[model samples]
Target: MVLETSSTAEASIRAPADEAAAERDLARRAQRGDPSAYAQLVRGNQGRILRHLLNLTGSRDEALELSQEVFLKAWEALPSWRPEARFHTWLYRIASNVAYDLLRRRQLVSFEPLPPDHDTPAETDSPEVRLHAKQTIGQLDAALARLPPEQREIVLLREVEGLSYEELAAALAIDEGTVKSRLARGRAALAQIYTRMQT
Candidate 1:
């Protein structure tokens, strides 16, 4: 459901050719007044949209509501989607902006878990190793909670989404230099916290 589209910026996202082509084709058809085609597009993208919302809201219930809202908004704005930008880019931009707006309005703290797909910890060679690994991950998660939302978002985009500076910039509506600086500072702060935890 990802690969085959030349417009997709994510080089690593792999999906069937027919599926990818079907998305653009459906989108193209939807633009041309095919209601069923639009439904297909929503079905194809709902999982990704939900994941984005879940990450942003840190609650499955809230994510489901927000995801529904995103699709509703997408449907309303579909006609305005410029052909120059990839469909996913347009969708993500809208979703991110909406999430930002919602967060600003709610003044809520995000309690999102460490991404489930984070790099795997090596298997423990001993009980001590297992304990240490658990302790380290817990410490990191605690430290992550202490970070500013901007810093946390940057970390998530880079580590979980695997987006580069350019993609990160676009996703966050920031400049490339800003992305680099934020990432550097975020890493430095994380290192400082981890160092403190060791003592």
Candidate 2:
């Protein structure tokens, strides 16, 4: 006699806990040697991790390889993970270490614009508009490249990754005040560079 709505059905199928709680539960399961739970966690985080690495390394190939390494390291260290810390933040700390090590070893200075992930009107617009968009992206990449690695990393994590100051601190093993100052300086430097490029 009762017809269930789609939303109600979805609600029933989904967990009652919030997303953070759900992630914690998954982390606990993963720590218990549940491959499926670990796989789910990887799937949830892989895209953001890949995009972040791509921006940091400036190469799609390097990003792909580094993403695999990050997951491998994460899985290996999962047993030591503390439940008090956020799972994603812990993973991010690992990722930051991996990336910074590679950057330092290579003394990498080259950079490329991130590949467009969205289909925007610019893509369908006139050739001139598309060209302008491409130039802007390139300019942005050049500006980012000019920043010191620390500032660039903080800027990307804060702006591109949308991580909070506290999250950035945790990920980079720095204090929240440091994160804020670095982000502010990075923004100011980036603005100066971008403005010069515009002129």
Give the number of the best model, judged by TM-score: 2
Q: What tens-digit string does per-residue lDDT give for candidate 1 at 57-125?
A: 666777788878888888888888755545665677777777777888888675555554333466755
RMSD of each: 6.5, 4.9
Which consecutive 10 residues in model 1 have the weakest lDDT in total? 111-120
Q: How does each model score on lDDT?
A: 0.72, 0.83
- Give Cα distance to truth, residue 186, candidate 1, Å: 2.9
Q: Please give the TM-score that candidate 1 achieves against the real structure.
A: 0.67
lDDT of 2 by residue, 112-194 (tens): 55555422335568998887777777778888878877888889888887888877888888899989888999999999988
